[model samples]
Target: MGKHAKPSGKSAHHAPGSVVRARPLPVRSAVRLRRPIDIWHKPALSAVVALAIPDLTLWALGRLDLILYTSAGAMCALYAHGLPYAARARTLPWVVLGMVASLGIALTAASLITSTALLVVCASLVAAVHKVVCEATRIGPPGNIILTFIAASAFFVPQHAGQVPLHLALALGAGVLAWLVCMAPALIRPQGPERIVVARALEAAAGLLRTEAGTGGGEPAGVPHARHATAAAVNAAWHTLFLVPVHTAAKAAARVGLERLLVRAESALGDAIEASAEDAPRDARFAGAGAEADRLGGWARELRSGRPLPEVALSASQAEELAGVAAEEPGPRRPAPGQPRGVRAVLTRLAPGSPLLPIGARVAAGCALAGWASMAVGVGHPYWAVVTAASIYQANTTLSWQRALQRTLGNLLGLLLYTALLPLMHLGPPAMIALALACQLGAEAGITRNYWLGSVCVTPMALLLTEFGSPVPATTLIADRWIDTVVGAAVGLACCVLVTNRRAADRIEVALGRVAAAEAVACRLLAAGPATGADEARDIGWARERLTGCLVELREAVEVAAGEWWQRALPEERIAHAEQRGHRALAGLVRRLSAPALAA
Candidate 1:
């Protein structure tokens, strides 16, 4: 039997002498609340470019008042972040179309309906769709909440049916401009995004090696965390590379070479895992692994700069070994089996059993309740309440709580900033436009660093946007905002508790099952000895890839489940066992590949 197989069928198998430390639930919660920030300036620049072109074009046409509609369309530029240029080109247009579709629905509903209740219902549906689409597509941060916020707010704005078509056309036109701005970066460095992703993966691998080497023996304390980081980087690198089609033979060969380098990086991680298992000496492994990692990083930089590949002193043999492995079993060129492909596939995946459904339900309920509550309490703009509620719903309850706190605090400080700037913004249309632009830039620049800091800018920009139509009393706006913030956040959090995701633990179990199945298949292949045919080799390769993918999914599930407030106790021991056994299986494959060379 495979080491990971359990007779009880509850606990997973663990490698000999491997101990899985069980962290206290409180400690896990506290640790997860604090995530480090990685700032990428490219997206900030992209936002500015996207917003500027349309705003300037409208100003030149003496129709600066239409900038609000253009700004709505410009928000589409925020999608497809971290994607390769080719992928962004395809994704941005889809995002723009989706945005336009949502806006059109909101405008048409607002024009036809006079009752606030019906409008709230319509907005809730839009919020639910936005939530599901964002989660299903993995659009990452500044996600569907923003889209929902804009669309829901549009529902409250009174509009004539005659004006709806022109507004929709404006959004579509601006969306095209946003798409252009996002794709412009590819002109200067076609391969830059993929290179940066691979380089970061190499760096993460180096960090893991260094951490493991410092521990000297047993499973390194930081090995799991470092491994998680390396896995994410490698996965991202693969996705980026896969998105770009290699039309020319030269591009194809170059892509294959880069993929081989990525495989070498993975092998280095496997070596570190094995060394940690066997109590290899710190200095020897560090010296060898560190040199190889640095060499890969340097090569990544060259690739980014479009320079010729440089020869490496330390990794030459390892590179040749990886090449042999590649020849024997090439990595997959497409997404793994069972991944969603088309619109139908995506819809099928988001059915009732999908984990994301509850999240979408929460957004819908929270936004609708908040809007109704605000209206009942006599707040001037109920959409602010809806937007606040939508923004606070995250992947789990714990994150939602944190976001609520951040949003409330940020808005308070933002109110102060808005008070100080109201006088300046009243100067003229140009002044208001420029200040709004600055706030947009600041929000984009700071959002990745801290949500609260981004909120500071977002709050002011939102306030100024209201002024584009007519000037209201500053004091009245401020009072309504304060009341709406408190009401929305309270109602949003209430919904989080009410709509509990009891299936979080079930999802974790399912993920563990996948990890076990994949590991078992790989172990069986290893036991059957070396491959007798290309088909056998390919099967082994696929099994290993599936195992790796399952492990990543398992980690994500465990983290998300740990953060939920009311979910059942997660199978931490079983999870640890599965992880340890999965690593051992991978290490076993690595040893088999290198055995003949070591003996010779």
Candidate 2:
């Protein structure tokens, strides 16, 4: 179709009979350094404390050789740091349990089998499971890396039937400690996680406002990325609010306070849409957007600090809606009857034709191939290669390639750092313990800066961890790790190239259908609204949220499919049309439900 011609049909990403091919890896972007994440210190500090208490206790008992089990458990602290406390409370125990289970399974297999080949296969399967389950649970950041690392490492450890239970128990004990350490902050600020997320939503909304708040604005000029960020942040803030418990008066008050600020930020979002969609510069309803942006930023600053939440006088309908929200709080929105719920939801996500399943298959194939290649290359510990392969798999093929590149570079740099630390590490367990803890701290604290930076610390830490059990020849160990890194990165990329994700293309169609369905529901709710009651407004808001979520999912599916190396040509035009329509409808619903909530 010509530029000015009406689009008659969806255009596939590529023409029929054309072969899909991989693009150049994102080498520079993968390694580039950036600022730390907002909660970087939480997981980093929690890991340090989690490891220290158990390590010191083990040392006192003269059982420092069992550091692997404890370290495995301690790493559980790295997960769920991004979750609200209410969710974290329920999630942390499961994470700990999963960690222990992974350890137990690996240990049992190792004890029963003497074949390094069999062991590698078992560990690779563990990595695959970890990848799928962690994604299903939405365990944010460092997702399956820690789980795979623990399982793969355990697969090579010398274990007997007698030792498996004890090891798992040790892991469980230390994981409990990590859980306590992670939850400690709740004692002082029960709403801390909610506050941070709410602040982030406000800040993101303010960012969008500033983008369009220009004096010489044309079409309001909000960047796509800024709008997307605002939408995601506001969505996350509401999720956190729902997950918060409100049985007590104090907790209820705190939730309502945060909800008030979030309501204002969401209103700013709605106004931005109204202002941009109508292209009316002099519209009075959108005139207060700048003032709203300033309030959002100020409220965000206050939320971030230890100060009280900013007070807002919600109009009557807003108050009634909030009161209803409070009444409905302490749980996630219920799924409709006959729809997948809880475990079923996870299973549904993992069911046939799901995009994540292909990635899991990729991990299994990559790790196995990398391990076999490492063994063929005569590396002593093929599991290192397995772990490296597992770490490289990300959400899509392109990201996997970038991680493969980054991991390779980071491992080389990490080996150099290990050599430098080798002398200090020879000072015995005490010095080794301190250095390992320091590396743990750096890995968590700096990972948000960039994955490659975290790998730099991780490499040295892994080498030091080995010394805890029994000293090895530094040169031999270093040489083996170097070899494994090369083999793993090479083979992992090979698997990614060879094992194509054709399902990714199909997912775009499913996502588009979901978006259409959600949009229809949103349209119905919007037509019925200027909701008279809290329940009706809540219904409109829910419809809008579902529609927005479906749009996000559609975008993700399209992006992932587009990045797959051997994917069939996706219907790019169809995806764009669906997303544009879905988002436009969502913006309309936002105006209807949120914009006037704080107009006073």
Candidate 3:
């Protein structure tokens, strides 16, 4: 039996000393408050260019009515943020195609079915499918929720079979435009994305070093956050590097150099974690790590600007240490596998036992309920309520609550902006297009900073979209929005409460066990002494990878479970202990791999 396993006969329902308690709303820390400006510039520019150029052209051609379909396709621009150009090249097209496909299905369903009940069912099914696919693929933010929002709303749009192809063509054209807009930067700076990702990792490493040094070896509260940030940055850097195809010797060499730098960064991270855990004194090694991190960050900046690669420099001891580790010759890089193919595979992966399944079900239920409640209460467009409900379903109930509050607040303020702009919009399509573009820019600009800030623009843009078909009175639109917001937020949060994830704690225990098991396996391998052959070395590498993956999974589980309300008190202390042990085990593995060089 595993060390972390529950004692026999102690029902899973009742872990020893565990008590059910309601987790209070984390009001202060729920939403990130710091607003950064530069990070959003490129995405905002991409969205505006993607949306405006086509819209203005359509208006010029007297095809302003077709802008709705085109804008639906262009909305795909909102995705692919933080992805490397290589990944974005694939991701953007996928998003556009997915949007077009969903639109086609919605249009067909609307044309074929006359009954509202059937339409609702169809929309609910689409939401479920989107939820499953997005979660399975790990598409990150702006996930399937936005895609579902667009499709669900379109389901109610009156359409004919003949109009489907033309509308789809419009969407396809705009999607192509969005793809181009997002990919354009790659033309000027082929390695820019990878550079940024690597740079971020280095910066995060430096941050952790600073925190460790400043705390005088005490485990500060900020240390975990910094560690997690560094881990995420490193993971993203590797993924980005892997996504880029190396077609030339020059590119391959460059990639190898980046990989070497990345390994050093990882080593530095391991050192910091171990030092912090052991409460070691700040030493020359720590200072050297910080300097190396700064150097790597500068290299990233130069790469991003298409400047020449900086010369690598290190002290004699540092060079020997790196050379010792490099002598081991780590395992060959295996191609990262793609997401599982086929609906069956995806569904199986997201089966009832999966953590994401409950969230998907909650989304479907909330969307359906919000739509029905809105219609019951005589709101003209139930889709708004449906979309609102979809948007409120985040990774956890705590986040969902924050989104609900942000969405409501932003929408209310947006309605006021819409009211103020109503007179200007009546001037012409050009004015309306300009206002929409501005709102989109604003949305993209602040979205990363804060959800509410982004929604301030998103709400107005959505309201203005209603004006494209026919003029609805501002008062009526405002009233409906407020009513829908209330209904959807209330319904969505209610679903969150009713559908509690009892397995959350259990999953945390499982993750803890996995981490323990993997750590033990790696530690055992290290204790057996350094790898004597290629196969043994590869085995050690795989073991370390498994351990790292388990640690990542464990951290994610703890974060999600921590945010859940009304659950048994988690064994947080035990989880922390496991993490510390895991880190020490990893550090030991790193030391063993570098032992040959260190000894020399």
lDDT digits (tens) for residues 90-140 of candidate 1: 888888898899999999998999999879878877888898898887777
Candidate 2 regions exceeding 4 Å error are 1-22, 215-222, 282-288, 329-341, 595-597
* Index of the highest-lDDT prediction: 2
lDDT of 2 by residue, 49-140 (tens): 99998888888888889999999989888888777777898899999999899999999998999999888899999999999998886778
Global lDDT scores for all candidate models: 0.73, 0.79, 0.74
Pairs that clash in candidate 1: none
| TM-score of every candidate relative to the true structure | 0.88, 0.93, 0.88
Which should have the higher lDDT, number 1 or number 2?
A: 2
Segments of candidate 3 deviating more than 4 angstroms: 1-18, 277-293, 313-349, 531-541, 593-600
